[model samples]
Target chain A: MKYLNKSWIRKSSLFILSMILVSPLFAWAANAVDYSEPLENAAHQIGAIGEGYSLFSGIFPEYSLPGTNIVLDTAVAGFFGVLVTFGLAWSIGRIIKKGNE
Target chain B: MHIPDGYLDLWLCGIFYLLTLIVLSYSGYKARENLDEKKVPLIGVVAAAIFAAQMLNWPIPGGTSAHFVGGALAAILLGPYVGVLSMASVVTVQALMFGDGGILALGANIWNMALIDVFVGYLIFRLFKNKNKSIAAFLAGWIAITAASLFVGIQTGLSTIFKFQLQTTLLIMVIGHGVLGIIEGAITASAYRYLIDVRPDFFEKSNKKEVEA
Candidate 1:
């Protein structure tokens, strides 16, 4: 009973108040995303999974290769994007370690 | 979020590239000075994870969607320099392989996403972490992306080639990233909490931790 004091109560109240204030910031600014096409395409072919919502497309617009092989192109780019980045960083880290030694 | 090519003038491009080079070199130096074999693999895995995560998009409250930019998460987990290095790696790969960002603007993207996000996220989280880990993470993610967006807006405004308005660019960039930052923060806090619980060793043995201490 003695442990529950005024300062503790104030702190708890403030935390709750702050949380209430923050929730609306998220609520106010949301926009609608068109998921209809993605949903429709995903139903037709397994390749559709590699369509509009690709890992690389949003960041790199040039990645939007408009061809019959769009799926293959995007997939290859996405996988290689990870591989090349990993390889480059790993090599740099390795070099620095060796230099210090 | 990747600015395509032809947006920046040659001089602006050079300046951004130079800054990125300096930071990249410095980070590499710091990482090497206390080289650990495990950290190399760790860096690779984190970079790859970030690149993969960037692919997935989450819808915002509005009609738009935003994806994760793992800069802050990397900074909090690995410390700022390593975080920058990790992000730089991701940006570089996207430019060269996917043509995701413009080659000229690539440096600027790295500056914004990697440099600014990592440092801001690390600093903000460190500042408020004593209060609550989740809140700190949220602020880190939110502010880091907002700050990165500001930098991009400035770069676009600065370019003599582009007729972009600074205020409008800044507004759109900030608002968009501000929303996205929340997602980034939640992802960071959850992922980080999981990591700290399961793989605390990664932090304990990190070169940045050793140096900072």
Candidate 2:
């Protein structure tokens, strides 16, 4: 095993542990009554089959309008936005670096 | 839990939207500080890749499907600020173009998923970076996602609480997100490994310094 950074590892583990402990408490306090049923049911369903296929059908219901156009538009726009932003950021970085050099 | 339109109190949605904008703008500023030109194209490419990946939803067992959230993974691969911005961009485009999430609830969605997932998750991942690169990466990716998923659950619970339907919403969000978390973790770990192998420089700490310089 790689010699781990003891302090870093300890801190990370502690932080995660704390968050894990604190989150449930926050959830419990946030709700006055038990709200575990729907989640349990959903879990049961996911557990029985698998995650991959189930998510598709669940989020995008068949009964709902086939919003294929919307989906495609979102996907396309997101694609280009990321592409453009990245290009701009990268080109600017190169320019700055050249100036520095 | 992409809160649909008219699900939550409008007041709450507005409050959250403002909060989301503030946090995202701040993150954007931070990202700009260290961002270099070379990395810009790469970031965009990665964002596109994440967008494509999210589109390819595999079916989950429980009459639902789950896809990569990519927020935690992005935070892990890039830094938290960049990750959150990337996610926010994705969310923004999705809302505006596809109407997947409520326009009013954009703030809540971004805060819960993008901010919490990316910023908090990456912070957790960085904490675990003990040079056991693989294990650290796995845990960081996995745990960060799990935490984010739970936050989404809590957000739902809060929304329902206001409506006196706290039990139902909380349950749905928690359970749905819990399972989703596992898928997220696996995908994140795998993706991180793949990226590290293919583009070691991208994951290198020195890259940040290079940008800053």
Instruction: Give Cα distance to truth, residue B119, candidate 2, Å.
Output: 1.1
Off by over 4 Å in 2: A1-101, B160-168, B205-213
Q: Which ten residues in a row have the lowest lDDT in candidate 2 chain B?
A: B55-64
What is the per-residue lDDT of model 2 for residues B1-213, given as tens digits with 9 covering 90 to 100? 455454455677787888888887676666666665555544544555565455444444333445566777777766776677667766655555445566776787778767887876676666766666666666655566566656555554565323434565556665656666776777777777876785577767533652353
lDDT of 1: 0.67
Candidate 1, residues B1-213, lDDT tens digits: the string is 776666667799899999989988887777665556656666766787787666554554334456778888888877777778889888888777666677777888899989999989888988887899778887888888889988977886676655556675566667767776777888888887877775666666562463464
The candidate that wins on DockQ is 1
Regions of model 1 farther than 4 Å from truth = A1-72, B59-64, B207-213
Q: Is the docking of candidate 2 incorrect, acceptable, medium or high quality?
A: incorrect
What candidate 2 keeps of the native contacts, as a fraction, is 0.10
Query: Candidate 1 versus the native: TM-score?
Result: 0.75
Query: All predictions: root-mean-square deviation over Cα?
Result: 12.6, 12.8
